[model samples]
Target: MRLFLLAAIAVLSTLRVAMADSAIGFKQTELPADAGGHALTISLWYPAAPLGKTETVGENAAFYGLEVQPDAPFLTGSRPLVLMSHGFGGSWRNLNWIAGALVRQGFVVAAPDHKGESFTEADATEIVPLWERPRDISRTLTALLDHDDLAGGIDRGRIAVIGHSLGGWTAMELAGARYSADLALKDCNRAKLPPQCKAPRLLGKVGIVGDGKADPRLAMDWRDARIRAVVALDLGPAAGFLPETLQQVEVPVLVLAAGVETPEIAAIKADSDYIARHLPGATTVYREIPDASHFSFMQICKPNGEKIVEELSPGEGFVCRDGGGRDRAALHAQISEAILDFLKVDMR
Candidate 1:
């Protein structure tokens, strides 16, 4: 009886070890570019069997210098790839929780920090064009598809993209969706700006207000045709242009809106509604978490931290109750589960 109990315990421990060993990492190589010298700091999280050689990439390192995990298990051959982009002024590391969770569930996750954005400083004089960020994603996908080490191990055809805030707009654009011109017009009207300035600018300062059409040309290059699904979290509304851009989207979309009262939450809901109504052939799923806030989707604020949550949400106070009573770690796990479930249906 004693021997059987010991054997059972050993088996359980080994299984746990095997689960931990299922992921590996690899380095990200900068892509050669003629325009603005594009550079991407990326990390890959995939399935693996436990060999102690693999190191978990830290957030800062993954966002700056490319870091890789090695010897990860490639469950049932090459796994599906999910490319994630962070919001403006946000680092790719913001999505690490989700990425790690997905990797554990047998998916290859690639996340890139957009140049001139993220934690890296951008030229203050020249604001990086919002339209160009999505191109970074497209370029990274191309690189991953071509890389020898990941070539046969990745299912290029079963690719997905997930984004948050401004990143959400990029995902929608990549799906060939257009936004309403009226949305932009309303903002410009409210600004008391001259009617003539309402015309969409080809290139200019892009803001949530008075610049809806700024990213008019932001959309996936159908010629490349790699991604199949998209998920946008806490996306804000369009400002300067018309509805034509979002109308072109044809892929399946999942929009996660945290709450409606807050500015950030309101923005996400508006974007989700626009996509759900306008995109033809689009199967849109919109979910609203009762007590979640925009910051809840990321690790930006925490209950145990130095009152970042209170500083951000003055009215609600610093209690974690406002954020569904789930701490940062739990929130991340919930988000990962939601995202993976969505992908399982859409990607397959």
Candidate 2:
């Protein structure tokens, strides 16, 4: 219901000092789904008993220079569960910094590698089923709360989901959004369409829109009752949802968008605005990060990341680089604090 200005300035001022004494240890584990889900390699950060070992945690192999204490014993205390969803073509390590900070603040954080969207997939089908992203979160939550090795000391009632980009769309869907085919067609038809939007339009031109409920998953209900709150970071294309559909979303939501304008980002910014105004029961706080781009929400690049990106794609810019003299670490710390604050109020 309000815009928070100079938000990062305030959050970072206090967070810097508080984090000096917070828990910075974590336990990394992998879990396989029983059926109908992707295999997950997740990271768990918690207040811990010193294990005397440190492991580098960043974009694995590519940018693993941020050293962290791994496999440390869990902190003894009641802690809420926070499930993190990465953006398309991203890895769980993209949000490792945020997860580490959340654990330091008395919350157990878990970031899962979503099917199709993760970096390991080798084919197109591995990444195109965007409809299943929310289900992937739901399945992972189930694994955390009910599966033996994975389920322990989790405060089920105080659960929350944090997602970025495509994962943001996933979080909204799980927060009780129902898709409308009609609105989807209309949004895709908007001026200055992005690459993803253009695909559906091309398909429609060939009369491939198909029959009503043709793709049952298009309008499927994927909301998980246990998700008490959601935090969407620079949410991706959301034309599939209308304000009326989002009215069904009753949980608290905090939607954040980057302050850059491009053909690709313009649509996403609009989606964030609509979601902020429409999600019914949420005491929504719509904020924009000054001087940030879409990739700003992901991991802070390592010292050699620019060279690495260039080597991978010649003549292309480092996709993860932030513009306008912004420090990725500072920006991340600010957002992480905001998330903790919002969840503390609503999850209580």
Candidate 3:
């Protein structure tokens, strides 16, 4: 028993040392309504100076968190900025893992818990107004540029955007892809209620689901020229964008499709495949991660994570699950490497 205790203590001591050595700094703040027409809750991660307390970011009952220094001073000198948006019913925490990885690569990352559509505030009426999501990213960029401490450190010309699932749709829009609500509904009508059409009856909720009279705002161009490149992961609602608009996107784009298929996940052919086909060949690149599922891009789950999610919301534990008995950490590493490589080449 004494030997076992000593071994446990040694293991914990090593973990503490590793956590203390993390180079990532994390900070969470609320930007006022004046900045985005509604209050925005955001998390920022960046390279840190060698000081401050190490704490886990995004820890919860179901998902594991990454260690980071809270409110640590950022490493000086300009660094590129990468803005992230989470999938439907997700918060900034959903992509916190990648944010930490990007920080280690000398990039500043910011993710906003989008108003109305975020995990805490999801509502059919609110989410139907999808244009608000891209606006949220723009407002976040504005806030960062106006921030006294962050402004000087952000390399404006090197800005890029990365997003997963619904957030992927948002990233494409900001990169100059114009949405076509009619096309979205047409695609939905053909498919057997693809994942995006399931919850909240996003299409039917607006009373335009069957009639095809989509909200005009859904067709608006939400492009933000500051985003020099875009990386979209397993994007849903991909059929909604006009092909011409996609071809017009001058910036480089990397579209990654998850390999595994599931009822709850978006279809590769209708979404990711469609984007790859329509996007300008010269500026767009597509890759599929064979071992990944739609949920694989999310944070790693705890050992009992699936059970915990099932208890909270029956049949919804897939968020805590992955495909083919694959390792989440390894998948994360693969994803981060792909993104870093893409950014390194394209952001130049």
Top-TM-score structure, candidate number? 3
Whole-model Cα lDDT of every candidate shown, in order = 0.59, 0.68, 0.78
lDDT of 2 by residue, 1-348 (tens): 221211345554454455455445665667766576557667666666555677776644345434567665555544578888888777777777777777666667777777555546664235545556777677777777774345247767778899998789889888888766656665445587644456654333322263322255657788889888889998865766768868767778888887775543456677787687787744667788876778777777777776876787564345556756667877877788778777766521
Who wins the lDDT comparison?
3
Evaluated at residue 165, the lDDT of candidate 1 is 76
- Candidate achieving higher TM-score, 2 or 3: 3
What TM-score against the true fold does each predicted structure earn?
Answer: 0.73, 0.83, 0.87
Candidate 1, lDDT over the whole model: 0.59
The all-Cα superposition gives candidate 2 an RMSD in Å to the true structure of 5.3
- Cα deviation at 110, candidate 3, in Å, is 0.5
Better of 1 and 2 by TM-score: 2
| Candidate 3 per-residue lDDT over residues 1-348, each given as its tens digit | 122111345653553354454488888888788843678788899877767468897888999998988888876666689999998878888899999887776678999887666555645237535777898899999889888475237867778999999899899989989887666666456556755445436665532455667667767788998888899999987776899998888888889888888876657535999898988887777998887899999999999999998998798998876677669898898889888777766521
TM-score of 2: 0.83
